[model samples]
Target: MTRTTTVRIAMNGVTGRMGYRQHLLRSILALRDQGGLDLGDGTVLWPEPVLLGRREHALREIAERHGLEHVSTDLDAVLADPDVDIYFDAQVTAAREEAVRKAIAAGKHVYTEKPTATGLDGALALARLAREKGVRHGVVQDKLFLPGLLKLKRLIDGGFFGRILSVRGEFGYWVFEGDWQQAQRPSWNYRAEDGGGIVVDMFPHWEYVLHELFGRVTSVQALTATHVPRRWDEHGKPYTATADDAAYGIFELDGGAVAQINSSWAVRVHRDELVEFQVDGTQGSAVAGLRECRVQHRSATPKPVWNPDLPATERFRDQWQRVPDNGEFDNGFKAQWELFLRHVYAGAPYRWDLLAGARGVQLAELGLKSAAEGRRLAVPEIAL
Candidate 1:
């Protein structure tokens, strides 16, 4: 018979879309349904979640919907429980730091959504506190686990991209303005005071993706814009959108390869996916999105004549070959949760810790500062 280790997790922010769908339903509940996580030594690690939220009704509804046994409106009471081993936070950026601080003080292992705090200093402080308290700490860096990126990583590891030259990424789709149609995103995402902006929101994701796949970002030059200045809220009331809806950035990597990315909530997508990245190298080039990747080798490169007087004859997009998904890919969020759970239970090495999260926050801080100063800025390394 397998020994069972029950790990109680206190989850905050289950009312939000990301928190509800990804963290709660897709990850924790999915693990529970699968009869706990296999710990490789015949010990099954089961997660018992206690949902924590500000809205009692919403929390109760979610708990009852899922057949969960526990729900709490008071974070302090949950944290005070000696049985709770981990505190998972998926709250908005503005409220994250305080809750995480309390969790750390309570000696709970902490895992949180990115931009761990609204600013670099707060994020770094969290890292320091977590370290001082001798607790396992992590922040979600889920993009690295995506199927498309996994294929890209496989290609790079196989020497498909010999001496990689550069990477270009496009991420975004038009978020409906609330006046004519309800906005897909929350109103707080357009309010700077509420810790919302494309730069702060996305640069952290870019930072880790680039750092892990290409190289560490040495510097950044960025321009931001508030393309939709007025938007209605969930209540359908008009309010000024002070935050930037778009950001165009050029990041210089440590290996001399430059990465240019355009992030926008206002732009319409004309590509295969909502987000896509094209990597160019000496031997070959590849384009990858959330679930697929296509590659073109130097030997198969197309040559087209420039003729202003005639219609284009070349079918450029058809030339690249699709990279096959060689293995089953699990949901990115659930995969990360499983890894983090193993790390918490069996002391497995988890690299995407709070310090890595702080690096992401550092990039966002510099990106925004670069936009405001109208100049390129250096990305200094952070240490705790």
Candidate 2:
């Protein structure tokens, strides 16, 4: 018989799309189905999740789907349980702080999805409280574990981007107006009052990605606009969209790399991927999307002359080589869950803590400020 360690996890806000889908079903439950993760020391660690949410109907359905008997609408009752070792919050951005604080005060280890809170101060406070309580805590930074970005990291580590210069990212596609067909995203995503906008949603992601792969962000300049004034909701009712639908931003990294990323819900896709980053270095350049990455080296460089008089005929697309699948990748969210669980059980060094999450929130806040001010703003280091 194989030895296994079972950790009880209380998952709050598991009824939302990201909550139900990523953290609950695809990650923890899937891990359970796999007989949990092997610790490589003859002990397998398993996660036992207690799903908690406000909607009893949805919670019951989700629990039944996962063969779980523990489902709760009474948060205080659930939090009082001594058996629940960890508390995970996949709640909406606005509600994250309060639930996490309660979990921390209840003596449970904390883990949560990012923009851990809507603002930087709240995020920082969570980190401080967790440290003071001497409890393990983590925040979702799933992009760092992505296979595409992982491959890019491997290249950077291997000296592929010698003296990296700059990074350019293009992300987004047109979301439907919800008149003829349903909008692909939730209606709340277009409302500023509800914590919805391109800047808040994406800058956090950019912060971690750039900081982890390249270096810390030093400064930011951004422009934001509410391109779509009205959008229909789930009830087929039109509502005024007050948030910025699009954001164009530039960031300066500590390693001297300049990163410019554009995010929008009102644009059409003409690029290679819905989200792609092209990193240019002295020796070469590479483009990485959600699942695919391609590269070009200095040795294969071709000189082209710009002439308006002549018909442009250069095979620009054929010069890059595709990166192959070196190894199978676990789902990004699933991978992070395994790591967080390992950290909880074995005291493994997991670096994506609440502090890292706060940095992401900081970037988003600064980006918005930069857009409003129409000037560059330095992202100063945050101290406890």
Candidate 3:
């Protein structure tokens, strides 16, 4: 057996929600708590995360909470530390490029949250820089790690879904208006200047899923809207909604498979959680949520249509069978964090690379363009 590699990691943006949850607490501390991670397929190791931030107090609090010994407010200082091998970025979208560039210059591997930058060019540039520096680079497309989505991928791969015809993805929830006594959500996520919006923020997940399950998106037609023009902050302060709240997009893929994605911050869902992807194929259809998978096949099709005017005899409802949970499930974000660490330490091939992320940004840009021009837009060819 090969001895495990010991990795020293510098976690940037350790104070934010995803940063705190995935990078610091779950990926670092949780893995340590579980002794060591077994990254299936023979990779077994652990990562040592040194939290980094710009605020001293926040960093101290986070470090102390995690019982971590190393924490720094200065990014350059953290990057310069010889002990740090990987720099993890969970910062807001706008700050990602600069921080990642610095990490590449410092000769450290990088794993960051998606939509690498505000545009595809920036994402490609970072990919180029990382290659030039000979460092591993990856972007989080955590949706792929969701057990439900993974099941969907398995089905697609296994030919359980013969010739997948279409996919419908529903993503979002009612974001608290930040009014009254509610604390304001991240300010950056609501302002276009800050790289905030449903389209740019969530399309990366869709991009990877579409690529993984079906094929690359060739073109797109979309419409985006800001349902609530103005919102109130935690302290009853008024703020303008500079970014879109909802987007509906159609993605045309390579093999005649079409995907329709709907992302919103204003819709309510009753049947399941906000995020779901349903695939309909010639052989069968599957609906997958964040935690569960259900299947309905041609063999189980309803025998007849029931009418209220006659005795009801519909049997299709019973044919839908629930697939059991495979095992312990990690939150999507945390799962990707573990994968990133394993990839960095064991040289595991990470599928969600910069090229995939750039494709996502390209889709978002094209989606907006399509919406503005009222025409389908070809996904711009990106230089990997």
Candidate 4:
């Protein structure tokens, strides 16, 4: 009989939104509820997570709510616990580096949300540290796990598209205008010092998706804007918006595939999740959204010439077909958490590593530089 390895994880920042979703509710409680899960290969075991945080009251509340008895405000205490085999960081971006360093020092495997650090250099340093410590490390590239994106990946891997051409990503949602006692959605997401901003927050997701679907980016040109300057906080206090609300960028991939990404918090979107990516290739085309995948291919019957003035008709509208769901739908974040646990426990190959995360920061940095300089910037070669 194969021995089951029980991995105990220390979940830092269990109080935050992503933290709660990825670590607590999904990673910890879900496993407990499911009586443990099996990775596809049947070799790895599920994980048990111990929630750690900075606020005792909040930590206790979370623990009580989840029926988790293991909760603490002292990170050092968690690290010192020999039973904690993996250190997961879901803290705010500014505090991530320090937390990760401590976790590495504690001889624990590490996983964290994207933009692993504030900038490229910090990300690289952490990557180096993980290697030096000889510990496994990973980052949340949840977008790659999205059903829509995964379908896209399958098509790409299967060569459904003859030769890749270009990709376009649209991501946004109209954030509430903070006024008249309206609570601010998330304060940390709007402050530069706190690692707020659509570019830094969302680009890491896109970078991995694009790289996985197409290839690594060779260069980028971008423009950014802060559309809303101020907003009301949860306590009815006003705070100045210090981060970019919108970012538009064009990326050149290693194989010459071009990608365009747009991220915004100011636009109202009709789509449920306000996220979609379209890929056009030599022999086929596909568009994917939160819960939908539409495809058009050369094998399909050909139609008359496309007319500019034509209304919605069979030639255009019928060209696309929606792909059906294969199983129950779960949040992409949750799916990634489950996968990460399986990887750490079972020796499953983790696709999203620190190098992938660093490339994300590299893209964002280049985008910022390009936007500031009013010119395109070639992405520097990263040592993988």
- Candidate 2 lDDT over 1-384, as tens digits, reads 689887888999899889888988899989988999887778897888898988899999988877898998887888899989999998767778889988998889998988888898898999999999889999898888877788899889999989999999999999998878899988888888888888888888999999999999999999999988988999999999988889999999997899999999999999877899999999999999888889999998778788999996977878899888799999999999888878987789999999999999999999999988889999999878
Best by lDDT: 1
Q: CA lDDT of 249 in candidate 1?
A: 99
lDDT of 2 at 2: 82
Please state the error at residue 206 of candidate 1 in Å: 0.2
User: What overall lDDT goes with each candidate model?
Assistant: 0.95, 0.89, 0.81, 0.81
Tell me which of candidates 1 and 4 scores higher on lDDT: 1
Rate residue 267 of model 3 by lDDT.
78
Query: At residue 128, what lDDT does model 2 achieve?
Result: 93
Best model number under TM-score:
1
Off by over 4 Å in 4: 1-5, 39-46, 180-184, 299-318, 326-331
Q: What is candidate 3's lDDT per residue for 1-384, written digit by digit as tens?
A: 545556788888889988887767766777778876786666567678788878889988877876788878889988888979989898888898899889999999888887888887788888888888889888888778788988877777788878889999898877777775463367557788889988888777787788877998888989999987787755678899899889999999988999998998877776576688889999999999887889988787566765779876554546788877767777777777777776776677787777777888888878878888999988756775
Decide which is better by lDDT, 1 or 2.
1
Q: Extract clashing residue pairs from model 2.
A: none
State the displacement of the C-alpha of residue 165, model 2, in Å, after optimal TM-score superposition. Answer: 0.7
Better of 2 and 4 by lDDT: 2
